[model samples]
Target: MATSVAKCFLLSRCSGIIRSVTLQGKLPPVCIRNRNLLSQCPSFSYGNRASDNPQDGHVNIPVDRLTVSYSRSSGPGGQHVNKVSTKAEVRFHVYTADWIPEDVRQKIILYNKNRINKAGELLVTSEQSRSQQRNMGDCIQKISDIIAKATEKPHEPSAEDIALRASRLEKRNKERLKQKKLHSAVKQTRRVYFD
Candidate 1:
């Protein structure tokens, strides 16, 4: 009877029908699923997408440095809101990212100190739309805007600009003095003079 049972178990195992089988103190344990199978899968590639390309945007920050996550958005969407996780959150480690220039990184760090966390990661979130893809795009765009504004250089005053500013200042000063002289003349006339 034991021989027939063992034969049946072996046949089921070989045919991939039984996922796991435990015999009473006689046979070894058998597991059909291998946990290490996922390790053999190919790595993700961020290339080819327009959003991933740094050259297409105003800021040249690479997409690979960003870590994106999703959670359920908090708003009035009823049952659909409860089911779908559409909110997108993007995290970028400014100190560790190698693509950004040192000056730009410093500027970003200084300007966006409020957004940076204890881990030195800039966290940006978006839940404006019901779609996850739109939220992700909004998150990325927000980060790009922050970096762009931080790295922007102030417009230097040219020779013409300096001259124009000087002329305007002189004109204002002259007008102010002329107004003062007219007020003084009025005051002199109103003065109580005894001859």
Candidate 2:
């Protein structure tokens, strides 16, 4: 279970892959909030936020904080693409979620500036799947995940951890230099007598 969360943390950075997870069928223990149950969870940027209110009105967002902007989503929609706004854009305001304090909002805005449009709205859209409901649900799930990330308390590596990382990197650098020197000598031996 802890390994799963670690995998999730590592995979979160990959582009265009939105992972939809349903917590309903499973027991409460598998919930996303419970992902940090490990004794010494490796310091990470996410999965550490304490809490959040899914409600947007309580915060502040256009069209009820979670406005579904319906644009005719391109690709595979075929004729339906021209007719319907099947693509639902789920908007979430970072400053509003109960878990995101003012300071954290600043960080979230900086971290996800690309996702947010010219306006203050953060857009998470679903067009990967065709079903309107599926797209919408997927969009909402992504929005929730983004909100979860926005509320996180940033992780700062401890001095000891930093030193350990530095030492490991130094060792790797020395090994690489030694291998390169040995390779150059092997190349020198292969030189033709015509040289």
Candidate 3:
């Protein structure tokens, strides 16, 4: 029975028809079909993982190292918004994360001091999703993306690059002096006391 069910799922997914998917549950298969179709009809998928962090394990956020919680959102959705906790706050302690390098950790701290609390944790949030689970996923993905960027090493300018910059600066100074002389000549032309 399990094998048959798996086969059914595989066929349905290949054909891009979610209607045939069903588990041995009380919910009607038609209801599930409708729900699946509705979910797939959306333009965006919350499950899309784009993080480059190696420790994320292909899920963007390594859920084991992250904490995500929910709170009620204000405005719109009437009672549901005020009553249910749909806002998700994702937090990670950069100071204690074993996977992060010391330099990278300090960079994150210095760059994200506003988001980091006194305990030196990086916090990201998402209240845009109507569902709490989706919001949490989005927040986790965002934090993961940020940390991934931070994990990469910074590039340094070479001696040749520095000399090129100095040459550019010298040219710029010459241009500025020429511009100033021209400006002074124009100003002198407008002077009535010029002999």
Candidate 4:
């Protein structure tokens, strides 16, 4: 009987049909028609031994690390806005965030010192959206943008920049020399010869 039910379940699963079948007083788990479809899903499944290093262009700042809060937004809205808390505030502890690299952490701290509080928490707030979820998303996005900007290395002077600066300096020097020659020539002509 179990074998027959298993066969039916397999056949149904392959045929993209969902049918409930009882086996030993328990219904078999529903099987998906396309097993590979899960790979196309946006959510990713991480392994137990996943690397924490973000050097592979993958930032591992989990949502759990951020502290999220909501409050009533003070803006131009009707009674619904007054009653509902739509503002979202997200706080991230820069000093304690182990996921961020040490160098990047220092850069974030230095670059966003004004935003960071005494507790070393970086605070970001969003109240543009009327919905709490949307405000929360905006807050998270703002924080992520700040972190990205902080982690980015400053644009160093490239070869072209160096060349351009040198050329500008050379041009200024030439202009100054020409001005000086003109002034000297005028001064010589103005010199009264008391013969």
Clash totals, every prediction:
0, 0, 0, 0
Superior by lDDT: candidate 1 or candidate 3:
1
> How do all models score by TM-score?
0.59, 0.49, 0.58, 0.63
In Å, residue 38's CA in model 2 sits off its true spot by 39
Evaluate all candidate structures by whole-model CA lDDT and list the values in order.
0.60, 0.51, 0.55, 0.60
Candidate 1, residues 61-175, lDDT tens digits: the string is: 4334567677889989999899998787878898987666677788889988998999999999989888765565466557656765665688999999999999999999999
lDDT measured at residue 33 in model 4 versus the true structure, 0 to 100: 42
Write model 4 residue lDDT over 76-168, tens digit each, in one string.
899978898777777879898887778878888888889999998999988987876556545545665665666566789999999999999
After superposition, the stretches of candidate 2 with alpha carbons farther than 4 Å from their true spots are: 1-63, 92-99, 155-160, 169-195
| Candidate 2 clashing pairs, residues 3+ apart or interchain | none
Whole-model lDDT, candidate 1? 0.60
Q: Is candidate 2 or candidate 3 better by lDDT?
A: 3
Cα misplacement distance, residue 162 of candidate 2 (Å): 4.0
Candidate 1, number of clashes: 0
Q: Write the per-residue lDDT of candidate 2 for residues 78-173, one digit (tens) a residue.
A: 787888766656665655644445655776688788988876767788786555555655664565455456545659999999999999999999
